[model samples]
Target: MNKDSTQTALLWIVAAGFFMQALDTTIVNTALPSIAHSLGVRPLVMQWAIVAYTLTMATLTPASGWLADRFGTRRVYFTAILIFVLGSVCCASSHTLGQLVIARVLQGIGGSMLLPIGRLAVLRSVSGEQYVSALAMISVAGQVGPIVGPTLGGWFVEAISWHWIFLINVPIGVVGLFAVHRYLPRATSTAAPRFDLTGCALLSLCMIAFSLAVDAPSQSHRAAWSTGLFALGLVSALAYVPYARSRRNPLFKLSLFREPNFSVGLIGNLVCRIGSSAVPFLVPLLLQLQLGYAPLQSGLMMLPAALSGTLAKRWIAPLIRRFGYDTFLLVNTLIVGGSIVAFALITPSTPAIVAIVVLIVFGAANSMQFAAMNSVTLKGLSHEDAGGGNSLFSMVQMLAMGLGVSISGTLVKLFSDQWGSAIFGFRMSFVCVGGITLVAALIFRQIKETPPAIASPAKPAVAGGR
Candidate 1:
């Protein structure tokens, strides 16, 4: 067979791993109400299951690149799969919210490595010319999982049971194990950097403390611990800046912030995501919680968003080519923010057709944002900086996903309590989320209008894996 086919196979395998990891994150968000009922917890208070996983992943992500660089990529990649499956089994069997949270931590520990290691494998295996295409392919797969996860999770809950949501991962894990064994290149760097344990500990503490503190009201009733954790988290995260300055190499790597485009892009992604990311979680909650929609109806309502996002990928490149990153992000950020505002207008009496159209537009615009921001962030990096920069970027993405939800939930709770109306709470939340997006558009405005820098031009097709 030819090189392109072999490389395509490898990319697909890597993308499969990514899809599994991302799918788990979003799938559980929608199924939380069902799972909470089974586990005997309040649906409003189940964010910890989500936060624990995301926080653990954020803490562990910095170390993944180092692990893959030291150990072979295939070794670490397979290890992640094994750990994730074990975590899933534990999660499926949990009888209490606490047990599920612990299990999710284990799952996050494993999930932290999946995308970075898989992407590392692809980067090391392919020629420089193929890096953008390879990454684009993987990004597309990663994107699809997030889109379908909610609807699929709801379907599973409605059709079978919540436990099956995790059980399904078993077969996919088995498949990934074999794919990695057969097709993955086992590679390691010769000059491995020393592991920075101190930095790692500080960052881990930062993530864990902040995450638990934020989710504390919803988790256990430990108000004191929540305050203490939030304090510790701030200190832990802040301490790293100076430590990174003093040391030769720090775990989180401060050098990445030096690039203006990257800095702004990362912030925009995190803040804007506060609006976009919470919707998937909140939409399902709204359906089951206030509207009393059945799981099946909720899932069906969700289909328009996911599918339209997938379809919208076709237009992203041309949009980027036409408007450039600055204009594209600015105009589209407003579009995204406005679509979210439209959700505030939703009432029980709102037509299903109107809701579906709104969701489709929101999902498409959100997908465009993902493709644009992600591409813009990494597009300028040199080969030497790509490894560390991308790893940090990924960490920020996960961290913000967790934090955004935490912050939004907190805001919603505060507003809901004051107004004494759940619908008012949701309305304010949507407006607040849109306001954040509008603010993010200003960040992208800082970027000069230039074509995004891709690694290398694509070559004519040839046969065999490089």
Candidate 2:
């Protein structure tokens, strides 16, 4: 193939991998109830499956860059696909919830590396001038994945079986494996710096412990265990502070937090996302389990949110330009949080049109929120610190996602048990998560307004904002 052809092929290969990863993220939410039925578990309790995958990704994502550089990108990318495909097969064959959760962990291991490694490959292969455009094309694939994921997952569950949602990845992975081997460049390996294994382990443990603590309520006889895990997570997080401070080359520098916007943005991203992230997981359950909608109908209901989010991207730059980051994020965070709270009003008798309008509003606000949040969080980092800051930011994004689902599931179970009504439980969960988001708006208030010229370049709307 010619040079252009190679680059084009490489782009498609990476885009396909990104699509597969992004697809699996949202697709499984729609299929959760079906899978729960097959596994003889409650749909709400099945969040461990989601939590395991996301938390595993969060745990491993920090290491992907080092792994790619240490090993060749093509080799690591190929292995990632293989592991992901193998994990997908395991997921399809799971006979129990335990088995499914284990498989998801395996899948998360691979899913975690797909995008980061693929992006690294693109960065090494493409020229500086084309880098942004190349990433833009690949990001389009990521965006399209979530747009179709829920609906496709629902269609598969209704039309065939839930397993097909995972089975679909097999063929894509098989083709990708060959294409990656053939098309991806084998960049010369450089001696990578010694990885901060201790720091990474400590941070990963903190995230795992915290996530498990949030998830503990869903499991029977785990109150004591939950308290212990929360304590462990806290200790581990605190331990990292002194450890990183002492280390010559920590996994992430403590100095990164000194950037006022970075600190504010990062915390706001985690807190605000906790509420918004729960929406995707909770909405499908609301439609199918409560409203008596079919799987396909529930999935189709998500289209308004997805489409509106896409349309809202264009407005982010201009809005940030006009109002600046502080005001944009402040106002938009409330809109996003308010939209989530509005979901509490969506009972069976609620008009479908009203629900659709809410989804549209939530989608637009949430999209702008992500674009603005990401830009502000990243804009303050110096060129030297940008790479580490981004990696840390990405890790937090995944952690927040897992934390959101874990908290939402726990809240649902708690409220339902207390009130003896699933609908009320769902309503309370929405209100609580929305309240959590509302609180984050105060964090965004810390951001100092910058002139339009000084604002960071807008990032493409990240799929699911992670």
lDDT of all the models against the reference? 0.78, 0.89
TM-score of each candidate?
0.89, 0.97
Off by over 4 Å in 2: 218-221, 453-466
Please give, for residues 205-286, the per-residue lDDT of candidate 2 as tens digits: 9999999888765455698899999999999999999999999989999999989988998899999989988999999999
Best by lDDT: 2
Against the true structure, candidate 1 has what lDDT?
Answer: 0.78
lDDT of 2 at 20: 98
> Candidate 2 has which clashing residue pairs, if any?
none
